[model samples]
Target: MAATKKARQPAELEMIGGKSKRQRIWEVIRAQRDGLTCYALSRRSGVDDCTTKTYMQALERGGFIEQSNETVRIGDEKQYRLIKDNGLEAPRLTKDGQPVTQGRSQEQMWRTMRILGSDFNYQELAGLASTSEVTVSPAAARDYLKHLAHAGYVTVVAKGKGRGAGGVPNRYRFNLGRYTGPRPPMVQRTKSIYDPNVGKVVWQEEVSDDDL
Candidate 1:
């Protein structure tokens, strides 16, 4: 019989209280406002290099994070922002049939509702928001619409009207207006792919993925 090497003892990935260490680490990493080094994360989480490195590797594989050199960044980072689009309808009115404004935090959402008159869709709302200097990610816009619909601030009319329809693309009409506060400045990122072998960031106007 061939001698099979005994499998290495599995390490504990989750802690006792409730959430696993990986989940906790993910939360902490997600809370970081800017790029974080793996060393910093290890120290902050009080996890040893072996555990931290293993968790990070697992996270990257799960698509929960992105890595560049020594820094790690969260994926779907845009979910933290608010979005606006046309598929939104105005908020519901009062007994008197007047616009009902809700809490301040819902302001941006309310604005979205108002802008999305009859049959107003995400594309139009996104265009309006982009032009208005309050840029929003397409992902954010979809989340906001669904939130409004769930809160009864708006109602979904068309379940799926476009090809991109899935969780969103459900048409909505507002039931009331709300405020979320002054729009935060849009984050403008310009990714410059680098070819360290060539010692420079690639700037070709057009290049196929194979070219890289």
Candidate 2:
């Protein structure tokens, strides 16, 4: 596992720009008002037809898309229409049409930050960001805030003291001038942060001699 840490797979490399196959397929579908068949999605989206069909199933069940009566007569080709147009970011879902909960915490935190204003601590961020369906921990919230501060989207207003009843958690404020868009900046597996709002990687971890 340690040896594989620095070694990136081809798939991971492809996702560096945040354009995954599912997202590509979703973009195509959203643009096509008349809808597209699974085969057509494969040809245009660069995703294989079978895999597109699988993704289509989940999207359709999730109410993001609906199947049209039109058929292309190639394989099990049937036209699929996009229903929920939630801007650029593709909806994350499982094969069973369930929401992929892995990334929800970031979304919650980002949304809360916008509504929360300034002088908020990581503990407060976590508490407000968490919903009945999802929970956000102080540690995760602190880490995310650190990246945001590094990226200039957030500012460190005050530093926290040591852990205790007397300890005060770090306070932060969202940089109104740095606000990009609705999408949250994501911390990638490579220790970089990508801002989907600006459609670019905003921050990356510096490489050290030890890593080489």
Candidate 3:
């Protein structure tokens, strides 16, 4: 056991600034969605108990993971599933028998919101979605928050500062405990050009604009 501990130390030392540690601990908790105690998390992540506890607490505070008296789980304590949508190259079955990849951006976001098990701050939402901070721009985030407020899926615990006071700080909380709605539509756009002199129009189809 001592030899094994020694061998894992180098790997543990590799997790500086706690980023890798967060990801590693998250992965371990994800692997066992049924939930794992801190000891179990330490064993699986190959991280020390203290490091695991510290990182786990941070994740919990960020709404990335959850902790009870002893057991640790992904995302919320009651939901026990991470509400995130990134790195989904394909579909897989979740513990609840739902397809991990539900398709469509709104569905993805909805699934993510549910997995998050509660409302989240914009930064938390973006990080869990593996999206850029700007990807969930203030406008888009506001739209979702408004919808959530109306649908009872969530409530605005605090109104957003409106991106004026340094930035928006809209905080939210989940009330529905789940997401259910029709998938959002996907639209494709094309541009057209016209020749005024000839009174003719070009559909701009079947040719790459770069070619012109």
Candidate 4:
């Protein structure tokens, strides 16, 4: 009788400290010398396209990875590589011991507030901030400004009447003197591309230490 062929087994995914699958995907990308395309990363991690994209976006926002300016021609997938080889994850606190904002949205708001140079209500602030090339809703802008005020990065320069017809909103001013928060990361814009998959123009930037 002919020898029966042995069934092939799938490679077992190694678990590090029982981390979630998303964390494992990050590890796989970190282990690679060259960056991996989203599709390739999904295949290696056994993750679906949507989940992989979500995790990648989270990592990118958290400043853990460097993304490529160009996407793969075949799949139109962006490539990403670990920013640091030493497994330096995003810090929850800044060097001054202040809590780090969860995402780039807050940072953009802070930058816009600094540019405003005077006390302004949330609506005016939001409208001016929106022109800074980052999408921020007026509601989100108001909430984040409140968060910053609570954190001592901003001051409630003036108060308004209760919510009523023709009621003026409280105006706020950026508190440059009291802020000990971390400086924004330096971003260097590179070439741009029009991703057909997303059907939008996208630009990539190299992030580095602001002091550098």
Per-residue lDDT tens digits of candidate 1, residues 1-212? Answer: 99999653212212323333444455557667246556667778766767666666544444445554343257422111112111222123333333344322234544555655675555545555453534555566665555444434457667764465454556656554432223211111222222222233223234569879
Indicate whether candidate 1 or candidate 4 has the larger lDDT. 4
Evaluated at residue 41, the lDDT of candidate 4 is 82
**Candidate 4 at residue 197, lDDT?**
22
The lDDT ranking, best first, is: 2, 4, 3, 1
Return the top candidate by TM-score: 2
lDDT per residue (tens digit) for residues 24-44 in model 2: 888888888455778888899
Candidate 3 regions with alpha-carbon error over 4 angstroms: 1-103, 131-138, 181-212
RMSD of 3: 19.6
The model with the greater lDDT, 2 or 3, is: 2
Give lDDT per model, in order. Answer: 0.45, 0.82, 0.50, 0.58
Candidate 2, pairs of clashing residues: none
Ranking by TM-score: 2, 4, 3, 1
Clashes of each: 25, 0, 3, 0
Model 3 lDDT tens row, 1-212: 35554433322234443334545666777667555566778888887888766655544554554443364367633323444423312123343334434323444455567666565775676555544422444445555555545535567787776566587687887665433332221111332322221223222345678968
